[model samples]
Target: MNRVLAFDLAPKKDYIEYINRGREERIGTMKVSDDYVRQCEKAKEIQGLWNPDVGDWIYSYGSRSIEKVFGEVTMRYTKVWLPVQEDLQAILRYETPLVMLQAFNDWLYTDSGYGCVNGARFHSMQELWLAFVMWERFSKVWDGKDWKVV
Candidate 1:
């Protein structure tokens, strides 16, 4: 059985709020245009980083590849952690039986995208910790019974 556990410090709503609050501009202030472009170029250095067949239309374009490159490092784990915002939706869309940890106040996670899988919503870090404990207990119970989880 392959078990994948993914977590994020805050939910998507916080991300949306931060993004809307000019967090990008704050980060951008320290970055030079030429340097940023170089960083983007470096992101595309790996092969099959994005669906090569799609050409440039790849979701993140150059940026997506950088994430993919790091994802490759954990390719052998049979489970991937996508604690970041936006990407989790993409992962759930493509992968089945996903375990998603959401926050009620989070704007990014809608009930619509969560398909046939396990999902838990938390209002605080304490709740999130409880969810993790529950997940571990459930996993142990299922594993003891020789149930297959993927």
Candidate 2:
């Protein structure tokens, strides 16, 4: 995974955990922008990365699509968004920035299985660090057509 911004530290609450928490709590408060939604789209494991639509098959991760994930979130949740700019300064503020970053990167890789922390729980900080490689190699504009091309 490619490193974008390198910070010595992170914030008290990582956005990933916040997202999972909202999911677990059914709070419907975890809202993300179209950009983040796209990022989440890239995070999913699509069936075919290159092939176009076919019979009884398409790019979908079970029920993990962006629409289903953010379906319950409304305008109230949208208002609370902090707006993570191109540099990703907003996410780096978390307590363990590297771990968070890596996890996001690994998640985006369709072949990656559960990233570093495989299971549903984080037994140690090491696991967080392991799963922190999911967001690397990501492009700002991923409309399933044009990605962040150099």
lDDT values for all models? 0.25, 0.31
- How well does model 2 score by local distance difference test? 0.31
Best by TM-score: 2
Q: How many residue pairs clash in each candidate?
A: 1, 21
Q: Mind giving the per-residue lDDT tens digits that candidate 1 earns over 2-121?
A: 222232544342211111111122221121122222222332212212232211211133222112222223232221121222322332332333344443223233332221232333
Kindly list the per-residue Cα lDDT of model 2 for residues 6-90, writing each as its tens digit: 2222442212212221122211233333334434334432211222211111113332222222223333322222221322333
RMSD values, in order shown: 17.1, 18.0
**Weakest 10 consecutive residues, lDDT, candidate 1?**
14-23
Shift of residue 37 alpha carbon in model 2, Å: 0.9
Give candidate 2 regions above 4 Å deviation.
Answer: 1-27, 46-150
| Residue 79's lDDT in candidate 2 | 23
Q: Which residue segments of model 1 deviate by more than 4 Å?
A: 1-71, 91-150
